[model samples]
Target: MLETYCNASGQRVNNEKSSIFFSKGCPQVTRDGIKNTLQVHDEQLSDRYLGMPTDVGQAKNGTFKYLKDRVWEKIK
Candidate 1:
């Protein structure tokens, strides 16, 4: 699958600036396999992009508290 994409695009993807992210419940062993399969480094998902949660998980309860704290800090 990766071979097909790279071949079709004829472009190289920079792994340093690019990454793959797995959901929280993914087992470490599975994560490792997926990362290796993708041939890119794993990276943390940014909580906020332009002052908003980047994904649904980050926007949900408890997790969003961090962003709220940042907002409160600026308002205060």
Candidate 2:
């Protein structure tokens, strides 16, 4: 699947430096299988991913505050 995506997208994936994200509902067995197949480590959830929230909780405003600030700055 990853290989197909890379082929289609023409983007190379560096497995050593990559991390895969899985939904909370994903089963452990499925996670393990995917990890093994991809030879990539599981993503460790953090406050932000590529400057966006990894997990947006009840506080949507707070979660996206940075984006709002960025837009406001751009407008100014």
Candidate 3:
């Protein structure tokens, strides 16, 4: 369900950025799938992105902005 979609989206994003390897599998879920799950959960998937943790000592503003931008871009 929602956890699966978030995990898959995270994996897909990591793979795309080479933060994680892709040989495992593509983790991109369909837009319809995300939409349906979000509806059931009564929350948007982007909310999960907002709550994602950044690496310690990383530039919070820059990194989060980048991740958010990328996630939204992919969603589009």
List all candidate RMSDs to the true structure: 5.4, 2.6, 15.4
Off by over 4 Å in 3: 1-58
Q: Tens-digit lDDT track for model 2 on 1-76?
A: 8789989999999987778888899999999998998888756666666778888979999878889999999999
Better of 2 and 3 by TM-score: 2
Task: Flag regions of model 2 displaced more than 4 Å.
Answer: 23-27, 70-76
lDDT of 3 by residue, 1-76 (tens): 6468878777432322222112224444544465454444232223233367534235677657867898899999
| Consecutive 10-residue window with the lowest summed lDDT within model 3 | 15-24
Task: List ranges where model 1 is wrong by over 4 Å.
Answer: 47-53, 57-76
CA shift at 23, candidate 1, in angstroms?
1.0
Best by TM-score: 2
Query: Lowest-lDDT window of 10 residues in candidate 2?
Result: 42-51
State the local distance difference test value for candidate 2.
0.84
Best-performing candidate as measured by lDDT: 2
Q: By TM-score, is 1 or 3 better?
A: 1
| Model 1 lDDT at residue 58 | 50
Backbone Cα, N, C clashes tallied per candidate: 0, 0, 0
TM-score against truth, every candidate: 0.54, 0.65, 0.22
